[model samples]
Target: MPASASASSTTPAAGSTIHLPKTSESEQLLKIRHSMSHVMAMAVQKLFPRAQVTIGPWTETGFYYDFDSPEPFTEADLKAIRKEMIRIINKKLPLERIEVSRAEAEARIRAQNEPYKLEILAGIQEPITLYTLGQEWWDLCAGPHVAHTGELNPQAFELESVAGAYWRGDEHNAQLQRIYGTAWETAEQLAEHKHRREEAKRRDHRRLGTDLDLFSIEDEAGAGLVFWHPRGARMRLLIEDFWRQAHFAAGYELLYTPHVADLALWRTSGHLDFYSESMFGPMAVDERLYQLRPMNCPFHVLTYASRLRSYRELPIRWAELGTVYRYERPGVMHGLMRVRGFTQDDAHVFCLPEQITAEILRILDLTEEILSAFDFRSYEINLSTRPGKSIGEDAVWELATAGLVEALSRKGWAYTIDEGGGAFYGPKIDLKIEDAIGRMWQCSTIQLDFNLPERFQLEYVAADGSRQRPIMIHRAIFGSLERFFGIMTENYAGDFPFWLAPEQVRLLPVTDEVLPFAEQVLSQLSGAGIRASVDHSGDRLGKLIRNGEQMKIPVLAVIGAREAETAAVSLRSRRDGDLGSLPVAALLKAAERANLERGATLELASPGKEHS
Candidate 1:
């Protein structure tokens, strides 16, 4: 049994002691957030007066105001508008919320030529509200604002950037300009936010991918197709190796499936009609249409149906690191976080109705085990029940839901219940792991899928020898390998743990005299399965150390004339700083031990210690 499956009292309960930053915490933050949006709207209006304001809401970190602008916002315009916003903040006008009737609100909005506000008013319930800023400026808002505009610290809020968003998060609607801004209660909080932003920028996967020669998204091949370079391939191989080991230990059978399948396969999976937009176009293969796979579930389901299963094989766990392709909008194509083509650490379990709880429990155990190996321990679990429009019968849905609840209870893990939040197919448990920087990323999901088995007519021989539909559970620990890599990069801030570090140790020779000794040391470390490299650049020792530190190499072995002669190396660690000198044999042993243990930091033997 995995450590997570073990009963523990430290586990959190749902909605207990979780710190969620809301508008109620700090009045200054709320005011700053509200006023900052108004400033952004004012800036947008000045830049493009025809742009109509729709709505702006305060998020956890910042606020975003949406507008129906004639021109799409550009990077340069963001800077100009930011300057304009600063001027507005300097004015320090008051913000007052005013209530009005439908007719009165309509008349005021009509006079201002704000048609979007009229539309907003129409959607709002009775007792409509509006916020007026010093009489001249007003927006249709139900606001909990600061007493005065002066309460908003101008320096504490910054207009981050602008993007094109749908009018009301609907793709069919017209696109609008979304100005994103971050606000804080005090200057210190603002500074911390800026520091975090800078840290995130520094650890951006795109930058690291280029600098570390990990991967590349080639423009020639079109967007979303990631080309993993040698270094990145090595890391991915290591990750996959560990993942396979863990999965096999957890009693999961690995499967390899094709990248493309016949369109009829998707039609049977019910994805052709509902999920076609996200899928790639079909290609003709000898008068038959074949489509690239956007998901591995259909393929896995087909495999299960390939043979008539037996109740004895109930809770058959199968896993695959299958690569998938999807059609994402051009502008939404972020680095690794959002990609069109990526691999998923997907798994599917086929089990009897009575075996649902045990299978789900096993999945939860595996999810935590796999994630925790990557230094992701804290998780936020959400249990989404059936939606209004769904395929499965009420009894089956109830059975699946109850099984999930029972499994969660047995595991002693707390999860939030998202009522009516499940997919049309079935209920699901989504796990969002908290990263090192206190940011959460949804990486694991366990969904009880009732639609796929029914659509495929999947059946198994029960104890009575009757053919019955087997319940399918779809789960993915690393939701997308690419996205998980991006999150991990940001979480570690590019300073990967010793085991995961691409270049674990860089042997820096003080001079040409020690080059041979450094190479020998490097070779020895490599032979011990350590990722060690010799700096052949022949740069000064200080420069070499600086370069190694800048690249975030976990360990640096400096070979000077005395140390080389004495068969010892001066050690420096990124995490522990300088640690005098140690014999080569001791250093190699420590490196090998860290590699085997998957330790975060390498623990070198004491100085002057020699292994004989």
Candidate 2:
């Protein structure tokens, strides 16, 4: 997924009776939110007569209205708007839908002196309509509103906040104040919505990134550029190593590609025409233009075109952890989830057209294996068909779509069809993983492109000694390394599993006399391929444990005189509480087992007890 596209809606919490559905999921929410936006507009106009309404629409979470006010709205204005909205809701006024001619609509707008509504009227199609609130206030709208304001629970709605927005989202146009608000069927659902929002805030990646000392975005250097600290770098390396191993096991060979190429390469690949907006400006070098790559697919295509291939070399899978850069607008740049510079775990497969089904199945299997390791077993899959403005033969598009559907069926994964949602160049499959908090994050995609192969003339010799274009499949398990890191951080709430944690174990020495013993234990753990460090801060035992817990270390071991003499260590695990006193050898064995199995918790047995 692109950095600009963030995660989707939240699901109902487990064991909770209240289910907070998104506006898209429920017809009642659609009507309620739609009516709420109009009610809010009426209240705003009643309070600030000079505020002219532009547009008010419902979102997945709630609704927002844009207004061209004389002055920006303040925090106090939001409270006043809420109070006024509640008052209007209490009036039990009938919301009447009125059909009018364009002339009448324009006449009413002229009478009200609302220029924004006039502009909106000019763009819309015929059968103009407006909704009247009570007897005095009204606005142009297409009605699916509640019968009356009495149907709305005044206590169920809230005015969220106010922000500045450009009219029609164009920076060149007039600026407007946008008021965001949320409404639900009942106050209980509203409470649940607020709780989820607060929980999301608590698990925000930016705060966790700082508190855990993982990564940072330095303003001095630039915006949207990530600086991975030592601990973060270590965890990233672990992820990379696992990715490499998984790809190799799945019959993939890794490749290294340049970050910048001649500007003509992009033109030949058609990216210069289609993706120029997201690309950085080209740089002049030696009388030629070189541009930073916003994608890795073109580079892989270049590699395939560089050499002629035979039929026997079909189904070639090549993967790359390629770093790419794009130009993100300043205000749109988020933490690690949305960055200008990030690594893409990109892979491309060149195979015969007939082998699409098998190749897609292989990719899906690998995706599941990799994602399940991080404890994301639940998924929502989407199969997007070709758009109307797409480039491909009808037969080819049908074949590609069929291949995706068949592969999904063979894998027994349920998917929803999204009409006209694919890229202009291909039909694709998108997979969204559900996080621990019931939020869904899009991280994996498999796109079958028929245009790239034709554009680059990527071909191989057929069995009959004729040349044929190879089918190209672009796949990425983690869409962007930085974005995936952010999602995973929030999913785990910064307390990473034992196998993936940067510091798996911390050794706390009881006193000065046990320093040497702690060192020996650390060496043993390190030799066993466990990341362990001796806490040499010389703080009290209680403080040491507290600090270790604060850092979210998986395990904390206490080294004391008796344990040292007995060749044992008292262990406290974040996932498994106290394990009593276990021998150093047992600790090393359990740590190795956890790493090998990618287990979340370590299982260690006492001297005479059986392992659990």
Candidate 3:
């Protein structure tokens, strides 16, 4: 039996629930996903005849299909499968949908000797549908596929990779070979997708982290625990400093919370029942259970309830750079992007219902200001409404959703709506910033939660001396500091701006005679608060330049006999080509100004005239 079957057969406890996105509502994404799955299934069957199809579905990125094959797929196999898929597209086969009774579907699946299909048929409801890819192939599916295979451009599709996936995503289910592919509407769209993939690979945080010697995840320390090297730590400190300054400017008071708390606090927040799976198991602390926190909201709430106050203390915006831990399954960890431990730049606001919209708007404005400083200006916003299994009352849900809508409108920003997609606790606004290559990454979220206050019986003294519950707004600008660091590293392609670069200037001496002058210039640069280093290896000028360039040093200053006598230095920059000689004072001033202004490159134009 597949791992998925083993996991699914033993159902959860009675009344247990899981959140999943339904395909019925997102018709466009669903059709693209369903059709892509069929294409993958057909490709796999064509490449490996012994392989029997199981199931495939579309995801946010693209579509993936699973097969129960005796032989594990290799990289070469994926290429051949992609070629076969293109051939199928050239045939322009019609994807005709046929509805059949359960009995008929079972008969056909059994006739084909596909046990997986038979199992799928048993689970499907009435009005069973099978989509036929021309005459040779068909799969059990309820699809809104394209009219014909010709509608899919052979040039617009690509087969990505093969991974080990359980038959139904459960680790215990039968392990199957999953083939992933992406398709778009036009050839240009396909090209753009490929470009984006290449860009993402180029900007992969793992590669940058190693090349730049920024951070690492050690197997000895256990997976998903990040170890920040000296350079990475310095950058993180700079970021933290900036974050603190911004929060103070935005009128937010800071807080510090413990990493472990009593298990009862989690129960009070209702995380014990609904979110225990993702949480670390409790530890025995003097006959009581204590667990490491996976979120900072509960701790912040406890601080709020530590002492009661009047209505004048309505919008208490408190922020923290709290680190939390959660248990993530082994194969799911990816560098700093998804980690088991991370520091969240979390903030919470307690305010009246009437202040919800304005609070959300302030958060939006702050998010934009902070992210834009890192050169991420373009944004893709999403407002998720109430889910079916939400906890808040209908009127409260409506009010919260309206608040988010009003805030978004007031900010004059366009956003997509994910209907019934909010967390069980509240509605939310998720913001994904577009990187240099147009890839979107979710990094910020502002959620209006009504469940927590009610669960904890949180109250503030009203103007009339009545106790009233204050609404809670949870927000995080950089969802995780480590993840944001990785993204920023990739965004600049490891060529950090002058203000953020690990070493802003590297002085290279052409020969032994120039070493003293190089040292003098380095001293001047360092005195001006510039990160400067001297290449004391005494290597050749060419080799020194090559080393500096390879390390992605922003500015390289060269000293020779002529420069030594003239008190000038030859300059070269990564963003700009070679700049001729300049006086030491001029170089220092430019470096200082660039660092202060956070300029991408130093402003060292060509020499105006030769020194007299």
Q: Highest TM-score, which number?
A: 2
**Which candidate number would show the highest lDDT if scored against the true structure?**
2
- TM-score per model over all chains: 0.88, 0.96, 0.89
Model 3 alpha-carbon drift over 4 Å, by segment: 1-40, 59-62, 86-92, 147-156, 184-189, 393-395, 604-612
What TM-score does candidate 2 get on C-alpha atoms?
A: 0.96
**Candidate models: Cα lDDT each:** 0.83, 0.90, 0.83
C-alpha lDDT of candidate 3 relative to the true structure: 0.83
List ranges where model 2 is wrong by over 4 Å: 1-8, 606-612
lDDT of candidate 2 over 257-367, digit per residue (tens): 999999999999898998899999999999999999999999999888889999799899999999999988776778998899999999999998789999999999999
Error of 3 at 413 (Å): 1.2
lDDT-based ranking: 2, 3, 1
Q: For model 2, where is the 10-residue window of minimal lDDT? A: 1-10
lDDT tens digits, residues 498-554, model 1? 999888999988889888888888889888889889999978878998899878889
Model 3 is weakest, by summed lDDT over 10 consecutive residues, at 1-10
Error of 1 at 363 (Å): 1.6
- Tell me how many clashing residue pairs each candidate has: 0, 0, 6
Per-model root-mean-square deviation over C-alphas: 4.7, 3.1, 8.3
